[model samples]
Every structure is written in C-alpha cells, then in structure tokens.
Target: MNSAANSRMIEIVHVNRTFQRADGQMVKAVDNVSVVIKEGEFVCLVGPSGCGKTTLLQMVAGLLEPSDGGIAVAGREISGPGRERGMVFQKDSVFPWMRVIDNVEYGLKCRGVPAAQRREIARTYLERVGLGHVEKAWPRELSGGMLKRVAIATVFANGSRVLLLDEPFGALDYVTRHQLQSVLLDLWDEGGAAARRTVLFVTHDVDEALSLADRILVFHSGHLVDDLAVTAERPRSTDSLLLPDMVAIKHKLLAHLGLEKRAKPLAIVQDGAAS
Candidate 1:
C-alpha cells in the first residue's frame, strides 16, 4: 500500500507467445503486449474467448514459456513455476484422492509444515470460504461449486503474493457463479483492510469483470486493446449496472469483445424505441 501506482509488481514486456500445431503451422496465441499490475490491485482480464488471456496468465504463473519477450515478478524474471504466484484453472485442480481438508493443506504439506499446524490453517481457510462443514468430504462427494470454493481457498491460504485465476467460474451455474464471485472479493479484501494480494482474474463475462475489478484490462485477438478503471464503491450492487456511468463502461468493454446491443424490432418496441 505504500507504493505508488507506477510501482509495478508484475511486468509484461513486449511479450509474445506462439504455438505450433501438429500440421506445422504456427499460431500466434499472444501478440506483442506489455502492461504492469500494481501491488494489491485487483484486475480482471476481459475479452472474447481465444484472445490469449489465459495464455498470458499461464506465462505469469511460469506454466508456459513465452515464445518471445519476457515476464517478471518482483524485479526478477519468471522462467519457471514458483510458490510466489498461485494459479487456479477452469478445471478443478483439487486432488480427487485427497479429502477436502487434505487438498486444502496440500501446498503446506509440500512445504513441510507440521501436520497439526497445517490442518488448522487449512481448516481455517476452508471455513472462511464456507467449506468448514465439509472438510471431511472427498472431492467426488462435493458439487462443482463446492470444488471451486475449495480450490480458491487453497490458493488464498498458500499466502502467494499474486493470485491468477483463469475463467474459474466459467462452468458454474448462474447462482453459484454469483456466490463465488462475492466469495472471491471477500477473500481478496481480508476484512476491509488493504487487499492482501494482487489478483489477475480472467473471465469472458463483462458483468463479472464489472462486479469485482478495481481495473479491467481489455484484450482482443491477442492484443492489449483497452484498459479501464472501475471506480464504483465496494460491496457493489448489481443494480448499479443501470447507472449511466456503469452502462457506458459495459458498452465499452463489450465493444472490445466484438459485441453490441441489439435493437428490438419495430413491432416489438413501443414507437420504434426501446421501452
């Protein structure tokens, strides 16, 4: 919180990533793009599908090597996966063989935390995410939304400085999606204190971005097209979407996603205008 906006926590410098198909054609997944995410800022990467948002997050997590350019964290270049950044994927990464509590503590276990201490910490986070009642349940016993709640809890409990989420709620039902979105915001703020960690969340849904982002970076066809800062107050209400400023922001975000509002047919509208 002491740093200025210019203080960059994550830097993407002229980064490009290309993939080779089995047919020997090279696909440019990420074009030359550069941006900096400040410490404790919550950003949502919004764009159409296949626009390289996830690819970019993967590079940040060191899960994929960039085809060109570079990505750095804390002034050090990221060449491989490290515990400093945590990632949650669209697919649940919860270990099927482990119980909910065990899965939550997996990272701590790997770091050799004493079993009793690790279990207590894991349970604490699980309860925070509203999973305390199911700590003894196995992955197969939980629903899709429950699994995601656990995955998110694990990521936050790991104490990573940066959290990267790749369309994590893309598969959940509408009700569950809204629930988890709220859960994520609460986890990030850590009880109204300064945000505990920097978050770069990816989602194709404009409303999701509006609901959670302190800033939103718009991507189009592998390019960094636009950046927006959402100044709406926290614990934001969905009704705020009707406000003139929020509606304008929504249209702008949709523009980058190749979308527009459709006009109603003359017969369906009152006096040929929207009702």
Candidate 2:
C-alpha cells in the first residue's frame, strides 16, 4: 500500500463502550477494540445479533460516546456528529413529508448551501443512484429500494468523506437486497477512486460482506475477533476467490458461538457448481 493508501481514515484505539442501567449496573456493550481503516477502504463488520455492531458503528459516527479509549477520523478525535461522516440505517429515515429532492438537499441546506448549488448536487447524486425521476415523489410513494437509494444519495450529496452503513439493506427482499448491494458497490468504487471516501459497512449476511468489503472484521460478544483481507479484484462476482474465504470465516464465527458442530454444514463445491 502507498503512503496515501496506508494513511488511516478512521482509527479506534482501545475503544470500549458501557451502558448504565437504572440500578447503576454497568453493561459493556463493546469491549476493548482497536481498528484502523485506511483511506478509501471498504470494511465490513459482521457478527451475530446483539453483538454490538451497531453500537460500535455509532461510536465511530459520534452518535454515542465511548466509555473508554478514543476514536479519530483522519487523526482528529471524533467529538460529535459532523459532516465528515455520513450514516444510513436500516430504517427509512427520509422525511415522509418532503420530496425526494428536498430530502436529498436537506443536508446541504442545513450547511447553508445556496439553493442552486444544493439542487445541482442533489440532482447529480439522485441520478447516480438511479432515482432521478423520483426526485419529485415523496418517501411514502417510493418503494423500499427507491427510498434507500434516496437516502444514499442524500448522504453522498453532503460530500462526506466517510460513510457508516448499519445494515442499510437488511429490510429489503432477497432480490432487492442483492440489487442494492451492486448499487452500493458501484457507488463505493466511484467514490473511492474519484473522491477517496472511506466506508465502514455493517451487515450480518456473509455473502453481502464478502461481495462489498476490501476487508471483513468479525465481532463477537462486543469484541473484534477477526480481521480478514479480501484480495480479489474489483467488481467481485459470486465466484470470486473471496467465496471460500467467506465460507471459512462464517464457519469460524459459528465455532466462536459454540455451534459449529451443531450447525448445518455449508455446501462447498467448485465455483459455479449447482447446489
């Protein structure tokens, strides 16, 4: 990796998060975790439910403060939510009353972007996400996929250097999820190559993480368990070299949960073989 490639985009050093209950008992949501994501890198966090993946992402997004340690973006500590980091959740967060274009432009509007420039930027991103025609439609009229596209466009229009996605496609159907996966991949590739935006995507689907991430991080019991690099080329297909690696990682995660032997074995065959 070149110096620019090696430079850290997001760094979490000995980060830990704890929540206090009404009775004053402390619950550790995330344990001591250290990770360094490089500029323009696509990294995914995957683990079982309740493993604190979202909590970890929230800490990085500055939505929640950590109990210990620190998180920094581009060498500056993350104090609170800033325009430098954009986030999209599984829920459709777009304002139902606002048109798609207006919602997409809302971030810029808050930042005091002129109306003309904001419209231009929002239009460009909406088109990029294949929602150009729906700009005039309200969130209620758009399909689930279209709503997500609009949300993504909204985030991109903000000119954020980093993206934090927390299972952004989890609610969509299988086909829609796969389709959005490709769309997101294209967007990431375009943004990384052209603008060098770093992304930290959180998903539970093994294939989804394999298809999109340059590296995959496994979290278990509020701790990072593994960090595996995907060495395949860009535009990775289902038959790419990362498939076996993903399968292995999945089994490893199962083992960590003490269910490897009890779990059904994954069908492993040659690439492109019929099930």
Candidate 3:
C-alpha cells in the first residue's frame, strides 16, 4: 500500500442531521460530530437505541444527507450512494425472488461487469462465507443466519472500499451471532492491509463491540461522547473479557450508556446489551 492509501479514509466534519416529527418539531438526530477513520480500520459505533448511531452510519453510506457539514471517503465528499461504499441493514436484505447466487451477483451485474467475471467473483465470496452449496437456493429456503451470509457476500463481491453495517446481527440468536461474527472477522482479515475494506459497524451490544472493533465510538443523545481504543488482543474470548483491563473498558462503556451508576460484576455486564 502507498502512503496515500494509509492516510485518513473517512473524514466527518461537524456533521449535523435533523428530522421533523409529526407534531412539527424538528429533531436533531446527529449533532455537531467530527471523526477521522484510518484506512483498513474496523470500527464500531456503540450506543443505546435512537442515540444516532444508525443515523450517522446512513450519512456515511450516503443513503441520507446531512443538514450541514460534510463527509468524505478517500478524499471526495459523498453526494449519494456510490459503488465505493456498500451497506447492509438489520432487516433481511436478500431479494426473495432471486436465487442465492443471483443475489450475491446483483451488485456486479448492475455495474455491468462481464457475466463470466462477475459470476466468478460472486462464487468466490459465497464460498468464503460458507454459502457455496446454497447458490441455487431461494431466500425462503435459507435460515436467518444464512441470509446474512448472502448479504455479506454481496457487499464484498461488489468490491466496496468502505463497508457500513447497521446492526446486521442484532436479531440473531447468541450462538449464531457469534458464529457470524467469526465469519465476518475472517473475511475482513483475509488479505493485506491495503486490500482490506474500512468497516463501520453499529451495535448496542458492548460485548459485540469489544469483540470486533479495533476502536469503539460511544454516542449518546445525538452526541459523540467518547472514543476509546480497545487494546485487547484479537479473537477476544469470554475469559479474556473478564481480565481487569477489559473489565475496566466495559465499565467505561457502561457508564456512557448510563448503566454504571453502581458498579456491578463483569458477569452482569456481559449478560446483555445496554438498554
């Protein structure tokens, strides 16, 4: 990778977004927020519901425009959804009418890549996500977890430099959620730093953020409250999370979520996501 590729890849400057409610009150979803994300970094945006984490992610993905300020990827200001960015939502994103392989290939097809070339790229990612055997299956035939695998494959096959995931695993069961997390990490770490994509993942689960993020951004009431770096080793485990340093980080995150007025055992904190 060249020096330019290693520089700041995402720049958000004093970005603000607001929405008007039914009663005619303008609500600010995102306040004056600014942050820089380096290339190839896996970052998590953590906060309770309606804290503007998802709203901020949408702005970065160019699915929604900010009321003021600006967001840029690489060096260009984002105007709308572009091929360089891809997003996966909490809800099922797979097309019900299309076969698994077709859904994975949709983005490439839209880009008008040669048919043979796109199919190969699609197949490669599908296999990487462990969905190769189901390429001909329908969305209805796949379980919730499998459907997410398809979505992951689609985003990667599209060759997006930035990946925005809005609680993509929030609805899954505990076991399945962890399994999918492993799959995501493996794919994200598959290549050299230059070949990796910059990921911004949003979740309310403190444990999830601790497990996946190189750094965690804590938001509350539409404000950037804290930005903490997770220095724990990669492939963090249940036991490692119980270590003194990791527990301290958990306490700090719980504090930001307004859940640590009184100190509690690490087990209690790990039991559930912040509410």
Candidate achieving the largest lDDT: 3
Q: What ranking of all candidate models by TM-score puts the best one first?
A: 3, 1, 2
- Clash number for candidate 2: 0
TM-score of 1: 0.91
Candidate 1, superposed: residue stretches over 4 Å from native: 1-6, 191-195, 261-275
What are the candidates' C-alpha RMSDs?
8.1, 7.1, 5.7
Ranking by lDDT: 3, 1, 2
Q: How close is candidate 3 to the true structure, as a TM-score?
A: 0.93
Judge candidate 2 at residue 44 and give its lDDT: 89
Model 1 CA lDDT for position 230: 87
Candidate 1 residue lDDT tens string, 1-275: 23643267788888889998899999888888788888878899988888899999999999999999888786678989978799999998999999999999988888998999999999999999999999999899999999999999998778788999999999999999999998988899875645568889999989999988888988777887777888887779978777787888898877666577523211210111011
Instruction: Quote the lDDT for 209 in model 2.
Output: 78
| Model 2: per-residue Cα lDDT over 68-105, one tens digit each | 98888877888999998999987989999999999999
Estimate every model's Cα lDDT from 0 to 1.
0.85, 0.83, 0.88
Q: Distance (Å) between predicted and true CA of 196, model 2?
A: 3.5
TM-score head-to-head 1 vs 3, winner: 3
As for lDDT, the candidate ahead, 1 or 3, is 3
